[model samples]
Target: MTPKEYFKQAYRLDKRIDSQVVKLGELRALAGCAQTISYEEKIGSPNRNTEAPFVKVLEKVYLLENHINEQIDKFVDLKYQMADAIETLPNVDLGLVLDYRYLQGMTWEKIAEVMNADVRTIYRWHTKALQLVQMPENPIII
Candidate 1:
């Protein structure tokens, strides 16, 4: 993979985790909404099923949360890998640019502000940084 593609893996994972969290929140809300589930069973004899009405939704929420946790773990590991790779750059300036853009996932404007440099200069540094990037032996695959 190209350097930019390799660096973006963490960002993609982060976004996926965020989306799962939002879905989990919505699922929790739906599970908690008792009014949404019917209390009345058949008008005839009582059903033999012992399972609670909302148990499925609650289980779904829990499963989603677990999935999100797993994704977060992946994201953390990927960040550490990326940071280590960035630190290996020959030039400190190039390393800083890679760290901000890839590890921290900062935008050009924010990186420029943090580094007290113009956006154009930051872009130049970023281009150079990508050129100097040595792809890790085992980059995290999306």
Candidate 2:
């Protein structure tokens, strides 16, 4: 993968994790709503079981949570690997730009504001940083 793409893995994973968490929340809501006291009883094996839906939703939420946790772990590891790679660059300014843009997930405007430089300069530095980036020998590809 290219340097830019390698660095973007963390960002993409983070977004994926966020979306999964939202889904988990929705699932939990559904599960909560499923908890209703039923006055009627099933005389025999009904067409479908009432508790099945809730159980399935709960199961999905559980699996999704596990998946999200695994993704989060991968993201953290990738960030550490990326940080080590960025530190290999000789230029501190370039490294800082990469850290702000990639590691901290800062936007161009925010990076520029924090760095006390113009947005154009931030862009320039980011370009240079990407150029200087040496992809890890065994990058954690998504």
Candidate 3:
């Protein structure tokens, strides 16, 4: 894949992951609310210790959530950086390939169906896209 295509794919993946992050954030907020409610209930009852372990668990959850958020932020920043790097390519056919494959999380066969191309073509586009955006001295797409 060309660097531009790779960038496009990375951007697409970042977007999809961003949405998932938002949903996870909402869930974390809901869990926090539930934890608060549990604590309040325990305060009025004799199960305060039962709530104690939960509070600790909630703390760990928040910690992991924070880590995930940080990772997402980094990914988003990388997306923008890559976009800036490959802004000159106007004939980029792999843009959609990247979007469908990474951002939309579509399988190669599915992308082939949507683009009216064969799976082999889609795979070629995907690989070309990755090559465009590949980091120096690193094969990792992300």
lDDT of 1 by residue, 1-142 (tens): 8998899888888888888888998999988887456687656647656578678888998899888888888888889888888888888888998898877888989999999999999889888888887888988886
Q: What is the lDDT of residue 39 in candidate 1?
A: 81
| Alpha-carbon RMSD to native, per candidate | 2.4, 2.4, 7.2
- lDDT tens readout by residue for model 3, 63-140: 767777776776766655554443433446676776666555578788999999999988887677665543444423
* Candidates, ranked, lDDT: 2, 1, 3
Better by lDDT, candidate 2 or 1: 2
lDDT of 2: 0.89
* TM-score of candidate 3 to 2 decimals: 0.49
lDDT of 2 at 97: 93
lDDT of 2 by residue, 1-142 (tens): 8999999888988998899899899999998884666689757766767565588888998898899889988998999999999999889989999998889999999989988999999999889889988888999999
| Model 2, residue 126: C-alpha shift (Å) | 1.3
